[model samples]
Target: MPISLSRKFQQWVSAKLDLPEDVIMDIPRITMIGHLHLYIENHSGLLSFSPEEIRVLLKHNHGQMIIKGKDFVIKTILPEELLLEGTIEMVKFIKE
Candidate 1:
């Protein structure tokens, strides 16, 4: 198996300092509240947003995170995080 240099570095640093690998790697952290609210952390950018779906660009090769549902709305958008509110039916990741 091949290991990414960035991932190896993150793993080393995470072990050295006892830090969470996700934080060290700048990985996306998602929080969902009963399919009603979604919080995405460490997002690179917003790809698209609408009442039926929302797509966000994730950091690294995690690809685009797509939220599918109805009456989708973005409550807040920050440089590294976002809050989405709606009836979320599904969440999928598509690689670019």
Candidate 2:
């Protein structure tokens, strides 16, 4: 499914409110490093990263990152993209 207008509206509101928008509205790019780390670009959602888990829900998949600690960051985020740096533990793709 495509992104909803409400998400775009939220993005606009976030921009206007000087708030950070969380929602992956476009095609995402994912990368894994050394089989222990992963990077996701163009992601959007309420992200919570900690020593226990890192969770994210994209257009097609929702998953958790198993990390040793809460030492992660959203490297970059734009209206159409985002960047996540951490260790990925699980990934489940939802079928439409």
> Could you tell me every candidate's TM-score relative to the true structure?
0.85, 0.40
User: For residues 1-96, could you state the per-residue lDDT of candidate 2 as single tens digits?
Assistant: 245676677667777888644433344556667535566655556455654455554543434323333445656656535454555455544433
Please give the range of 10 consecutive residues that has the lowest summed lDDT in model 2.
62-71
Clashing pairs in 2: 22-45, 23-44, 23-45, 24-44, 42-82, 51-69, 51-70
Candidate 1 per-residue lDDT, tens place, 1-96, comes to 355876788799999999987788887999999989999999999999889999999988789999999998899999989999999999998987
Model 1 poorest 10 in a row by lDDT = 1-10
Model 1 regions lying over 4 Å from their true place: 1-3, 15-18
Give the whole-model CA lDDT for all candidates, comma-separated: 0.91, 0.53
Q: Output the number of the lDDT-best candidate.
A: 1
Candidate 2 — what's its lDDT? 0.53
- Where does candidate 1 clash, by residue pair? none
